[model samples]
Structures are given as structure tokens and as C-alpha cells.
Target: MKINRCIAPLMISVILSVAGCSSSSKEDQVMNANLGAQALYDKARESMANGNFAAAADSLSALDSRFPFGPLSHQVQLDLVYSYYKSGKIDQTLATIDRFIRLNPNHADVDYAFYMRGLTNMEADNNLFQELVGIDTTDRDPSKSKQAFDDFRRLIQQYPDSKYAADARQRMVFIKNRLASYEISIARFYMRREAFIAAANRGRYVLEYYPDSDQLQQALEIMVECYDQLELTELRDNAMKTLKLNFPDSQFIS
Candidate 1:
């Protein structure tokens, strides 16, 4: 019995030693993963700063695989988003932003995340004025501009104290002006097609809904022309009076 007891104690010691080794192995693995992630992160940053966005994306992706939940994982993910954006991979950039927003809605830098998404979409706009001037052959997709403007507006509304809020507000103004101009363009197209009532209504809608728009004067001028073509003399006079009252110096008024 004593020998059995001695063997039992020896067995316990062996088991404990095995358990301790297993625990140490796990800890070592964690440490190695963290180190690997940090090394990859450093390399990725260097590559990005040197304008090697593709290399930076690959390095960061490697870190993601090696240390999926490691300490630098979040930062690597964010950097990956920026790398994809800078590389002009629009779909990947948008997908990464969506992932970040879904995963870390309450994160402190969530505002910046949303801001980055807005900036990405905004930068993709090739200027509505250029499109309007017939310099670009692309079909006008106001939807993209609308998406960017809405995203920026959401950022400003949700994170008013964010550093990007002011810039977002300014971008919103540009977007609004473009939107109003597009409306005026459509109004003019309707007038040219002898759809005078449709053109008059569109112009009136712009003046009413977008009074602060930079295109307000042009919209009012379109309204005056449309109303006169429709023989709505009273409406034409009213539009002229309103345009003169609001923009006496506007070239459209003269």
C-alpha cells in the first residue's frame, strides 16, 4: 500500500509537470504571436509611408493571419483599410470600413472610421461642375455624390465634436450646391423639350427646398423662363421679384 501511495504521488507530480509545460507552451505561443504581429505592423507602416501600398497591405494581411486577436490587430485592420483606400481599391476600402463599423461601433475612433468612409466616397467624385460642362463622358450618377453627402452629414450629426465635423460641414455645402445645380439642369432640359409645366415645377421645387443653395439664382432664372414659356405671367413676375429680393447682384437677375 505504501508503494502504491508513493507511485500515486509520483504520478501526481508527473501530471502537474505536464500541465505546467502545457501552460508555458501556450504563453510562449502568445508572446511569439504578439512579437510577430508587432514586427509585421512595423514593416507594414514603413511600406505604407514609402508609398508601397500593395506591400503594406500584404504585410498587414500577414499580421492579421498570424495574430487574429493579438494586441495590434485593431490597428492593423485600420491601417489595412487606409492602405486599400490609398491603393485605389474602392470596394475593399468600403468593405473594410463596413467591417470596422460593425465590429467597433463604440470604439473611440469610430468617428474617424466614418469620416474615412465619407472621405473615400467624396474623393471619388470627379466634380459635378466638370460633368455639367460636358468635359466628362460618364453618365451623371448623382447617387454617388448623394451617398457621400449623406455619409458626411451623418458623421457631423453623430460626432459633432469630432475634428472632421467642420470639414464635413463644408463638404456638405459643396454637395448641396451640386445637387441644386443638377436639379436646375434637369429643369432646363424639360424646358427645352417643351415640358414647360414640368420645368416650372422643378425650378420652384429647387427655390423652395434649397433657398440657401449657391444655385438658387440660376434656379430662379430657369423658373422665370419656364413660367414665361407656359404663359404664367403672374408666376414669372413673382419669380423675378423673389430673385431680385434675394440676389440683386446676381447675373441671372439682370
Candidate 2:
């Protein structure tokens, strides 16, 4: 009986040790979910190359979480941003870009983040339905356009020598034109409502801020009409002179 009791205890201890070892090994396997950082990055790259951006985003997100301190971490984050953008996940793209910019202010590719942010905001404001239906959006809210303009402006000012600077400058011009048109639309609305002072102020705002916009002539015309309505003869004459000076063939000139 003594011998059997001693043997039973020994067997139980051996079983517990084996079970403990097995559990430890499984935990290690779960902890090191990935084979290695390089292999996972390669997998993500392959997914991206296959045009499977959702899969690529998933893989890249996993790699980012698993190997945040790895040598390829920056590149991984950039790739993830691209994946999110290509996947049409604008919110995620913007959030990831903001996080990247905040975390890597001095990174060599930080300029890319700014460029992507501008592009994403521009995309967010693009109403495909309105475009297809031929609905004019100039009078609509321009909050996203304003944000995109700010992003591009910051990129151009802060990274003048960046490779994307030229493109940012071009986009800024387009945004300025759009914003000018928006102001003109509001001024016309005010004119229709008989708010001559408000309309003239909006026109002046366009001239002051968007000098090179394509809507310069329209702004001047609005100013002239509004000032005349308000009985401001001097301001009306000044707006007319400027309009004739700039646009010799303006309808308001004759």
C-alpha cells in the first residue's frame, strides 16, 4: 500500500509537469504569432501587389502591431496607409495618416503623409452622386475643401523642396478657384436677397484672398452691382474700373 501511494504521487507529479510544459509551449507559440518581421512584411507586399488592398491592409496592420519596433516599421506604416487609401477607406486612411504624421514628424517620408492627407480630404468631399446627376456643388458646404486646402498649403510651406510640392501647388490653385466660386455663389445669393452690403463684402473677400482665382471677373461684377445697389458710388466706380482694367471685354464694361 505504501509503495502504491508513493508511485501514484510520483505519476501525478510527472503528468502535471508534462501538462505544464505543453501549456508553456503553446503560450510561446501564441505570443510569437508571426514567423518573423521580414516574412510578414513580404506577405503584406505580395498582397498589395495582387491588388487585394483589404487583405494587404489586414496583413500590414498585423505586421504593424506585431513588429512596431522592427527596422521596416516606417515603410510598413506607409504601405498600410496606401492600402487603406486604395481600399476606399477614407476615414481609416486619414486617421492612419494623422497617426503616422504625429508619430513620425521627422521621418524622411513624412511629406508623403501630408500629400496623402490632402488627397484623402479632397476625395472625401467629392460627391459622386452629385457629379453624376449634374448637381452644382459650388454653393454647398466647403468644409472638406477648406481642410484639403490647408493640408496642401502646409505641405507646400513646410516642404517646399519636397518632390510632391509641385503637385501640391497645383492642387492649391484648384482649391482656390473652387473656394472663390463658392464665395461668388454666396455673394449672388446675398444679392438676390437684397443684402447689398453682405454681397459686396463677400466679393471683396474673394478679391482679397483669391486674387489669382478664375472667378476674378465674376467677383468684380458682383462687387460692382452690390455697391451700386447700396448707393456707394465711389466703391461701385472703383470696382467697375478694376473690372475694366482686368477684363477689357467684360459684360459690365459696356
Candidate 3:
């Protein structure tokens, strides 16, 4: 009986040790979590270089969680933004950039963060119908374009000497033109509907807000047409005279 009891205890001990060994390996396989932040970041960069944005994001996110206050935290956030953008996680990208900007407003790379924020909105606001079907649906709401324009404008104003300033300025011009053209389209639509007052107001808005836009002459012509349709002789005549003075050879004047 003593011999049997000793043998039973030995068997139980072996079984427990074996179970512990299995659990350790199983835990490693089940989680597969990286141990070191730097190593994980290096792996993320390697994934990024190979165009594996999904994996790169995963590694970056892991590193971020594990080492939020680490020296590479900001860089990880920036890289994660790029990775999320590449992987089409636009919301995540924007959120990441915004957090970075809020946290590191005076960082050397803050301009880049602002530029990326603008780019994100610009891409989001793209006229997909116009690009894909060659249709000019300019009457759509310009809210996204306005947001992008604000972001780009802030970047330019705050970082005039930044490398991204020139591009931000150019994008602002494009957004302004788009917004002006959209206002014109709305004005013309109102005119077709015989809502002459609304049409005139829209034209005036374009003229006042988008003076430097290419649509300036069109705006003047729209105001002239709407005022004439509404029998506002004085306003119509004033708009016509201004158009003639500013654009003597404009097709809109005719």
C-alpha cells in the first residue's frame, strides 16, 4: 500500500508538470503577442515596406498599447496613421492624426500631421460621380470640401515655410474653385425653377466669398440674369455694367 501511494503521487506530479508545459506553449500560440516594443516596431516597418499595411497596423497598434509613454509613441501613432490610410481605414487614420496633432502641436512634424489631415478630408470629399461617370453633380453639399479647405488653410497659415505649404495653397485654390462652381450651379438651378430671389442670393454669395475664383464672371452674369428675371431693373443694370467693366470680352457678358 505504501509503494502504491508513493507511485500514485509521482504520477500526479508528472501529470501536473506536463500540463504546465503544455499550457505555456499553448499560451504562446494562442496569443502570438510580440514581447518587445522596439522589435514589434521594426517588424511593423518591415511590413510597411512590403505593402502589408494590415500587418503593419496590427504591430503598430500592439506597440502603442504596450508602450504608450515610450519614446517611439508618437512615431508609432504617425506610422499607424499612414498604415490605416493605406489599408482604407480612413476614420482611424483621421482620428490618429487628430490625436497626434492635439498631443504634439509643437512637434517638428506637426505640419505633416496637418497636411495629412487635409489630405484625408480632400480624398474623402472627392467627387466620385464626376470622376467615374463624367457627370458634373455640382449641387451636392460642399461641407466636406469646406472642412478640407479649412484644414489646408490652417496648415498654410501656421506653417508658411513648411515644405507642404505650397501644396496646401494649391489645394485651397482647387477647393475654392469647386465651392464657387457649386454655388453657381445652385444659382442656375434656382433660376430654372424660377426662384429668382434665391438664385440672386446664391450668385451674390459666390461673388462676395469667392472673388478670386474663375467663376467670378459667371457669378456676375447669374446675378444679372436673376435680377432681370425678377424685374429689378436697377440691380440688373448695375450687375451688367460691372460685368462689362471687369470682363469686356467675356462670353457671360453677352
Candidate 4:
């Protein structure tokens, strides 16, 4: 009877101790999860501030998965987009922006989302005809550049007073110059091949569409050359007159 009583007390103590330990472990796990989430968020912010975008992205991704719909979720989503952009993951950047836009169209930062999408595409431009045309079409697509320009334009149209408006205007100028240069290049190629009509038409198109382009002088000069080659005396004289009127001191005209 005495031994039985002793064994019973010892067994109860052991059982209680085990239960206490398990309870403590469960609490510790909860505390650790909360702390880990906080630590991850802090590390992500630090990495972003330090320009370690890849590390920040990884940390933020962990936080996102662990604490989905948590208090910091929205901020984490935006940070992920910025992180992808800073890390040079252009496609990811675009996709993230699209996702954000689609998810939160009325969010306060929606304009920024659009602006970032435009900026992403603009930065990824390859400036190669073959790459732009996908190797199947010999034609110069310019669609990527056009998409970027249209995006920026949409931001300006919808959010005229946005902080990105000035930047969008600057990007538009760049797009215009790029388009003008492409046209001028095609015109010169035609000129070299003695395709005078094609060359003149291309040059005229540039002059008509991109009057503010830096290539204006070169385009007019090409027109003058093209008309001269075709023996169109009136058109050649007219092109010369226009060239002189626009760029009297241009080296090409002189």
C-alpha cells in the first residue's frame, strides 16, 4: 500500500511536468512565430534601405507567406514590387505591378502602380529591331516603346497632377526621339539603296510626325538628297528651301 501511494504521486508529478513542458513549448512557438515575423519585416526594411534588394525580396516573401492577410501584408506587397524592380527582374516587376493594379485599383498608390509599369517596360527596352520584331517579322515593331509611351500617357491623362507627370513627359520625349531616329535610319538605308521615293517618304514622315526630334536636320537633308537623286527639280528646290528656313546653319545644309 505504501509503495503504491509513492508510485502514484511520482507518476502524477511526471505527468504534470510533461504537460507543463508541452504547454510551455506551444506558447514558445507562438511567441517565436510572432517574433520571427517581426524580425523578418525589420530585416526586409533594413535590406531595402541598404540597397540589398534581393535579400529584402526574399525576406519580404517569407513574411508574406507566413503572415498572409496580416497587418503588414499590403505594405509587404508593395515592397515586393519595388524589390523586384530594384533587383532588375523586369518581368516580375511588371507582373507585380499588374497584380497590384488589378487587386487594388482604387488604392491611393494606383497612379504609382501605373507609372512603375511604364518605367519597367521603358527600362527593359533592348533597342534592337530583331528583338522587337520577334525574329518572324522583318518589320520594326516599336510596340514595346509604344506600350511604354501609352502607359505614361495614360498616367498623365488620368492623373494629370501626379508626381510622375513630369517624368512621364520626359519619357515621352525620349520615345519620340527614338521613333524619329528609327525612321531616319530606315530612310538612310533606302537612300543608300537608291530607293529615292521610299527614302523621301520616310524622311517626310519623320518631319511631319516628329518636328521636335533632334533628327529634324538630318531628315531634311536626306529629303534633299532623295529629291535630287530623283531629278525632281521643283521638289529638290523646295526641300532645300525648307531645310534652309529651318536650319540655316546646319552642317548638313552648309
Candidate 5:
């Protein structure tokens, strides 16, 4: 009723300042609501549900960083593995899976971890030609393929009753057959170069290591051709006879 002008202005300024601070605080909270591990984890799952794999991977990574030993640590890591795979982070997927398998060997979902590991390795990039025609894989690095094969084999042997066992067995067969075919490619390359001895050695490697593969028939033919080119009569005749015995209608027998 009798306020001085100076006092009234000062009071008004104070109220305005307080109101600004409250608004700013609420805004900050809203902006930072996703900083917590639980929030980030939920966001990651939601992103995954929507097929936003890249966002899911980022959120899962944030969750892992924020709560390394939190209640959801194991699940976060496991989810990160899947998110990384779906987002095409092949290296990250493989590394996360290996870490999971090593740290949680007896975990209930260890079989799934192995299966994912195999899938990551199997999906690793190969030579362009190999990716298309599936030849010359042996000429290139076969390390990942071999690793994937072993991973699948281990999963099948260790967890025969696992839900993933059937798929693992099928993948193992595919990898084994591909490996055998790779050997045949190598043998064929050596033959084209007229390196008969080298071709024969490759053929022998396939026959010895992949006896059950479909490429075994081609390996026998390679041995026969290479032995003949090298003028090894005894080896050539033996290979020819084996080829005839195994593939009675083999076109190369004559």
C-alpha cells in the first residue's frame, strides 16, 4: 500500500530471477533424463523393438558405460552383442561375444553366445570374388572361416540339446564344405599354372581333411591330372583307379 519505488522494483527483480531459475532447472532435468543407466537401457530396448539398430547400439553402449556393474550389467552386455550385430558392427559384435563367452562360460545363455560368435565370424567380409563365386577363399585368408567352423563345432558338441544346436550343425556343415571347396580352388589354380606337384599337394590336403565334402570328387580328379602331368605313372594310375572306384561314371576317368 505504501511501498517505495526502489523497494518495489527490487522485489520484482528477485521474483523474476527465481522464476527463471526454476524454469531452467526443469528444462535441465528434462534434457538429462536419459543420463541414467536404466533410462538408457530402456531406450535401447525400445529402439531395438522398432528396428532402429544403430540407435539401440548407441544407447546400449551408453548403458554399459554408465552401469558396468549395475544390476543389468550382464544383460546390457548381452544386448550390446545383438545390437552391434544388427547395426553391422562386425568387429564389435565379435569382440563383445568373445568377452561374454570368456567371462560367463557357465552362464545359462552361453550356448547362444557361442552361436552368435560363430555367426559374426562367418559373416566377416571375404574376398569380393569369394563373396560372389565362392572360389579362391583358400588363396585369401581363411582364419575367420576356420574360427567360425570351430565355434559352431564347439557349440554343437558342448550343448547338443541347445535350441541353437540344429542351426549350429547346419552351419558347421556349410563351413566345412566351403573349406573343402576352397582347397579345390587352390588345386585348380595350381593346375592352371601347370604346377603339377603343388596341385597334387592341394588335392591331397582336401582328400585328407575333408573326406566327406562334395569337393572330394574334384580332389581325386586333380590328383589324377597332376600325377599324370608330373609323369608319376604309379601315382597317376592309383589316383585314376580310386576315382573310377568312387565315381563310377566320372568323366575324367578316361
Candidate 6:
């Protein structure tokens, strides 16, 4: 009985191992059976031209898996990122971007990947429904916005003269404004709850980190009000003076 029990476990293990190998072999065979690298790339391009991003992604993924180091490898990775992004596969787009950036950091076109990373993260922060409904996202989590901002910042810093640098700078401005606006929203909420310290701190953060934001005036106003509430006369006067100097026509000037 003991011998039989040991043999049974051994046989089961052997069978499982064989099954795993067979599964992997099948996958390899399928990859091999696909069109040649060039043909597959052409197919993906055609699909992309037709606005069939899903089909293009499939073909490009298959090409990438079958020919990881082929002559078209770099182009395949770039195309895969674009197709995945167009297909709304944010995770796949990011994974491919990370892989490309990791493997080809010094490639001439790496800046495009960085730009696309920012664009993807920005897209992830919004949904079609939210756009259609005109929902207020200022109070929503800003983590994705922050990530996008970092991506664009890195692109600008590393590829200052890249073709996409101008657009990246523009997007960075927008992201800073959005982030500052979100902070102001939080500060306003804290003010409503009589959390003067928290409100003033948020305003201070915007002033310190996002001075170029369009919400600078609002942040200064909030800081002044919060400091007044907390009886911080010096801080209130400083904030008020800054607000007045910057925004002479501001309603809060008085």
C-alpha cells in the first residue's frame, strides 16, 4: 500500500509536468504558425489604418512574442503601445511602455513613449460617462493626474528639444492647474468644516509647488481666509498682500 501511494503521487506529478510543457509548446507552435514578422507587421499596420486597434494589437502582440529580437522589434513595441492605448487597454499600454523604456532607454524615439505614458495616464483619469455627464472631478483623487504630470515632467527634462516637448510643456501647464484646482477644492471643503489649519496648509502647498497654476489667486484667497480664522494675523496679512499684488481686480482684494 505504501509503494502504491508513492507511485501514484509520482505519476501525478509527471503528468502535471507534461501537461505544463505541452501547453507551452502549443503556445510556441501557435506563435510560429502566424504570419512572418514583416507580413504580420504589415497586417497590424493595415488594421491600424482601418481603425481596428484590437486586431492591430493582437497581430503586434503575436509578432512581438514570436520575434522579440527581430529587426522590427522596436517598431513592434511602439506600435503595440499605440494600439493598446487606442483600444483602451490602459494596463497593456503602460506595461508595453515600461518594457520599451526599460529596454531602450537611449533609443532616439524614447521621448514618444514618455509622452504617450503621460497621455495614457491622463486618459485613465477620465471616463466617457463622466465627460458626457459633465461631472465635477475636482474633488476626485488626483493620483493619476500627479502620475501624468511626472511622466510629462520627465519627458521635458530628458528630451527638452524633442518634437513632443512643446506639447508636453502645454500639458504640464494644464496638469499643474488641475492639481492646484483639486487642492483648492480640498481646502474649500476643509474651510467649510472649520478646519482652518488644514485649509491653510493645502493653500500653502499650492503656492509652494504650483505657483504657475491658474488657481494661484484662489489659493492665496483661501490661505488668507484660513489664517484669519485661525488668528494668524501675520500669515493672513502676507497672503492678502500677495493676492492683492497679483490680482488687483480680484473680488477678494478688499
* Colliding residue pairs in candidate 2: none
Model 2 residue 63 CA deviation (Å) reads: 1.4
lDDT (Cα) of model 6:
0.92
| Cα misplacement distance, residue 242 of candidate 4 (Å) | 2.5
**Clash number for candidate 2:** 0
* TM-score of every model versus the real structure: 0.77, 0.84, 0.83, 0.72, 0.81, 0.86
Count of steric clashes across candidates, in order? 0, 0, 0, 0, 0, 0
Model 5 C-alpha lDDT per residue in residues 1-254, reported as the tens digit of each score: 89898899999999999999888757644543557877778878988999988778877777777688899989988999999998878999988898888888899999999999999888883555565975545566677889999998899889999999999988888888888888888888888999889999999998889888888889999999899889999999988988998998888966
lDDT value for candidate 1? 0.81
lDDT over C-alpha atoms for residue 165 of model 4: 91
User: Model 2, 1-254: lDDT tens per residue?
Assistant: 35587689899999999999889757644544655888777877887999988777877887888889889999999999999999999999998999999999999999999999999999888899999999999998889999999999999899999999999999989989999999999999998899999999999999999999999999999999988888999999999999999999998887
List the candidate 5 regions with Cα displacement exceeding 4 Å: 1-33, 126-139
Q: lDDT ranking from best to worst? A: 6, 2, 3, 5, 4, 1
Pitting candidate 2 against candidate 5, the one with the higher lDDT is 2
Please report the TM-score between candidate 4 and the true structure.
0.72
lDDT of 4 by residue, 1-254 (tens): 45687699999999999999889757644544566777878888998999989878877777877897888877888898889889988888888788888888888878888898888887776545666676532235567777898899999999999999999999999988887888888887897799999999988998899999888988889988888889999988888898999999966575
lDDT of 6 by residue, 1-254 (tens): 35587699899999999999889757655764667989889888998999989878988998999899999999999999999999999999999999999999999889999999999999998768877899888888989999999999999999999999999999989989989999999999999999999999999999999998899998999999899998999999999999989998988777
Q: Candidates' lDDT values, in order? A: 0.81, 0.90, 0.88, 0.83, 0.85, 0.92
lDDT, model 2: 0.90
Strongest candidate by lDDT = 6
Which portions of model 1 show Cα errors greater than 4 Å? 1-35, 127-139, 249-254
Candidates' RMSD to native: 17.4, 13.9, 12.7, 15.7, 13.5, 8.9
Among residues 3 or more apart in sequence or in different chains, the pairs in candidate 1 whose N, CA or C atoms overlap within 3 Å are: none
